[model samples]
Target: MGKPLSGKVTVVTGGSRGLGREMVLAFAEAGADVVIASRKLDACVALAEEVTKKTGQRALPVACNVGEWEQCENLAEAAYEEFGVVDVLVNNAGMSLLYPSLEQVSEAMFDKVMATNLKGPFRLSALIGTRMAAAGGGSIVNISSIEAAHPEPLAVPYAAAKAGLEALSVGLAHTYGPGVRVNTIRCGPFDTDIAKAWPPELRAELARHTALKRIGGPADIVGAALFFASDASAYCTGATLALDGGFR
Candidate 1:
């Protein structure tokens, strides 16, 4: 019942849709000025307005492709310029490439998945974590996937990339400690429109196997995210809070 994160400034990548959008809104509701970023300017701007209106919190909208290092740099700079400092970062920009097999996968397709799903978060966390260290301390939450653990064959690139992200989270914590916390949230099939290529039957199957017996909405992730960004999880670092509802 404590408003533990009052006045904190947090940044969320991919804030235009899905879990990212929900987190940005949740952070605002919890009394944090949020910086929302996405590849689309209109989307980020729109979410910024919505967060401002809904939660009465300061929201800064930024356009950036997290896959590119330079764009990630600009995002951090823009957020800092808008809010003076950032206390939390959510590296949530990601996508998956579903192919039948490794033979069917194009190098370009594999690279795209790896770059966006893994390197993007790595780069963004690096830049933001640096800023956080300079400022004394901060929290970084990277959105990973249960696929990293379960390893879906059709999504080889995705699973591998997310696995790398989880690895980075653990490795990063050792380097960024005393003042910074780095963690990953291994998420399952969310109800966001993000799974455009996933067959409906497969989605249903995924839902059926989970202990919760349902696909989670964006809201299902808000509580864990808030804990990561707030003082509630001050002792947590180098951890992956599996948001998969205990799927097999």
Candidate 2:
């Protein structure tokens, strides 16, 4: 038998770092050609080179700011132009800047957050998913956040955007399915670059809420990502998988 994702092509936004980076490597190891899209072209190139060197999978690094609708469209066109069809599309790019209070959240800040977290995914998924349905079948994986369901005051805009993303997954599934599967990964705190800035007390408090008693690692997301990207999740669609270590 072939590798699970052998001969497939995948596009992952935010593929330059953190959980996105891990997923890119995992997909390559599973024998898929990957398109790494992020705002930072240099970072994407670096990771793409690493992926090819390590796994011998073809990697295309493209600079894309998912917050922009045109960029999202260009990203899709670029991916299809290079690989013909995208077997898996992961909408992983997002941002949540800390604010002192909801009142302090500027219109610009809120718009930027929403554009990246919600609007970008909606455009990309609609573009690729529509094509997927017409061409035969494919998978669309959205990276949401636990905050979407359990909002924190510091990042209301982000939470709202993520909540919208979750809704998009379900609606897109209904519209594109039979051939396209849309699902979401509602992630919790993970030990990534962002964690380096977290205060010890805050981290400790976060850990206490998880059943596992600790935050997740970047690697922890690879398995679920692979499952969704490959035939392992053949029967699953319009679902949200919580990879939050049982946050309560």
Candidate 3:
């Protein structure tokens, strides 16, 4: 059979690093042109060059802070302008800050978390998913966290935002259904750049809690991502798939 994503265009926020980077590379390898977006323009540009060199697929690097409403709108416009159509969008940008205590969590911290994790996705989906519905069909994959379902003290704000993101996915699916698909990937801890700062004991504890006995790796996200982004998931919408290695 032909490549599942051949002739397709995909936009992935946070596409310059970590799990987002993995998905970007995999999509290009699967024969899709890509828009690589992140806060750092240089990183996005570097990865875009690498993508073209390695996969020979077109790559557009866009600098964006998904936390800002105007930036999200600009990103959507840039992607459509360059690619003409976007067949898939992956809302993968997220942030969680370290604060001493819940009482110490300033309004700024909470707002930033909500903006990046929940608000950005909602706006992007509304903008692009509307166009997707009008143009025929598309897929939107939201990257969420296990914390959404199982919140902990250190990440209450982030957890709340992710929970909202999951809810938004369901609503978007209904609002744009028949021509668009929206789904959530509720992820467990992965050994991404952020995990490098985790204490050894904490890492061990996380692994011990998972049925897989280990945290996920960057590449582990590819299978689920491809399935959802391609025609393989044609009938699936308003679904939440746990990609958390059986995190409890």
Candidate 4:
């Protein structure tokens, strides 16, 4: 089979580690030049090198804290400056800080979570999706969390932000339709680096609740990501695909 993303350029926020890193590598292997954006320059640089070595596709590493609006603009500018056009964009950068209780959650913590999970995607999609529509067409894949639907007490703010992200995807699809497609991948508990911080019982509980009886692996995300980013889902837009191993 031919490379699915040949001659395409993709940008992935948080493209340095975990699910983001996996997606970056997968996109490159599928024949797409990639722009890897994250807060850590070193990690992004290393992954960029690996991508070039493994797939011979050019990779641009950019340091960006998606929680800030200016940084999001800079990321978009850098990608366009380096690659002329971007065919795919993956909004995968997100965070949820721990707190003693909902009542004790600080304003800063709440804002940071909202900014990273919701605001950043909004800005990037606005900037790039507009260009994509004008230039012809493109795909935008948003990485959301199942917590948006099944909100837990400990993660209410994060869940709210994710819910907003899903809503944003639907709105963006309409805002840039016919030429640009926007979609969301609602993810469940995956055994990514972040899962290492999860307690054992929490992990077991999550697994038991899923029909798959196991948490997701890093590679589990590749199929859905490719589908949304490529022509495999050509007619699909404003849709949400659950990648949670049937988490209930």
Candidate 5:
């Protein structure tokens, strides 16, 4: 396919590793100027440089705590200072708490999960929404999880937070329409730290639940991210696409 996202400027959160880094690299490869933000400045910059070296595209690494409103604001401002305007947002930073139930969840664990996975996206989206609205329009892709749809009972808190994230996407799809597009990607268990809690046997067992019978790599969800960020899905919004290696 052509560089469908050429000339666009996209921002990916949590771009230090795993799916976030993969998406950043993918967008750069697709010819988009990419700005990636994460708490780790060193990792972010290294990733940014790697993408530029690999794709010959513009990439900026910014240090920010997306869960904080001020940092989110700075991320938007810095992106504009770098590229003039942002055309796409991938809210991909996340965390998971795999406790047996609500009673087993800690106060800190619950709050942290809600902040990073749900609140952070909300803060960043509001910033991107205003800019995109003024610049005509833009696209937003929220990274959710299949756990929200077909949850692991032990991960009740994570699943619940992700489910809320899905609702947030749907709500924004309408509330910010005419100038913005919002969608969710419900990703399945991937070969990432997010699944490090599972034992080898447990991981394999979970993999068996998917039609593909394997854990997805970091790059597995890039296609969905591309579709949401590019004109290919220009007519799409308020939708959720599962990139779960055929988890069904």
Candidate 6:
């Protein structure tokens, strides 16, 4: 059989590294052209080149900071211009800064987290989803955090923003569906570069919280992302699937 995502055009924000990088590669392997976007143009370009070399699928790299509204618009325009249509949109750009305390968190920091996590998805989904609906249909996969539903004291602003993201996914599904499908993947800790800084003791504690007894790996997310992006989950929408190893 043909590749599941053959002929499809997928856009992934924060596509330079970590989970976003893995998704970008996975989509290309599945036979989809991709748009690699991130704040760092060089990383995006490098990944784009690798994707083309590895998968023979066209990859367009665009420098974009999802925290900025105009940049998000530009990213969409560039993708449409390059690929003509976007079959899958992955809102994966986000950040959670460590603060000494909630009282110590600055306004700028809070806004930055919210803009990247919540507002960016809102704008992108509206921009791409409307076009998808008009043209026929498409899929939007929002990467949320398990903390969105299960908040912790450490990343309060980030948790709130992700919570809002989950809400946006469901709302967009209802608004753009029948033609478009919108869903979310609420993820837990993964063994990505970010976790490299995590203390080993903390990592062990985190593992104990999950049914799997270990944090997820980059490849662990591919199946869930593919299911949502392809026809495998055609009947699903307005749903949130957790890839958190059944964290407690």
Error of 4 at 188 (Å): 0.3
Q: Which window of ten consecutive residues has the lowest lDDT sum in model 6?
A: 1-10
What does candidate 4's lDDT look like per residue over 84-194, in tens digits?
Answer: 999999999999989989999999999999999999999999999999999999999999999999999999999999999999999999999999999999999999989
The local distance difference test score of each candidate is: 0.89, 0.95, 0.96, 0.97, 0.89, 0.95
> What is the lDDT for 157 in model 4?
98
lDDT of 3 at 112: 94
Candidate 6 overall lDDT versus native: 0.95
Q: What's the TM-score of every candidate structure?
A: 0.96, 0.98, 0.99, 0.99, 0.94, 0.99
Per-residue alpha-carbon lDDT of candidate 3 for residues 72-172, written as tens digits (9 for 90 to 100): 99999999999899999999999999999999999999999999999999999999999999999999999999999999999999999999999999999
lDDT of 6 by residue, 132-226 (tens): 99989999999999999889999899999999999999999999988899999999989988899999999999999999999999899899999
Q: How badly does each model clash, as a count of residue pairs? A: 0, 0, 0, 0, 0, 0
| Better model by TM-score: candidate 2 vs candidate 3 | 3
- Candidate 5 per-residue C-alpha lDDT over 154-196 given as tens digits, one digit per residue, 9 for 90 to 100: 7777788899999999999897897799999998888876677
What's the lDDT for candidate 5? 0.89
Model 3 global lDDT (CA atoms, 0 to 1): 0.96
Better of 2 and 3 by lDDT: 3
| Residue 95, candidate 6: C-alpha displacement in angstroms | 0.2
Please report the TM-score between candidate 4 and the true structure: 0.99
Task: List all candidate RMSDs to the true structure.
Answer: 1.3, 0.9, 0.6, 0.6, 1.5, 0.7
Q: 114 in model 4: Cα distance from truth in Å? A: 0.4
Query: Residue by residue across 180-218, what tens digits does model 1's lDDT show?
Result: 998889998888986666698978898898999998888
In model 5, the Cα lDDT at residue 71 comes to: 90
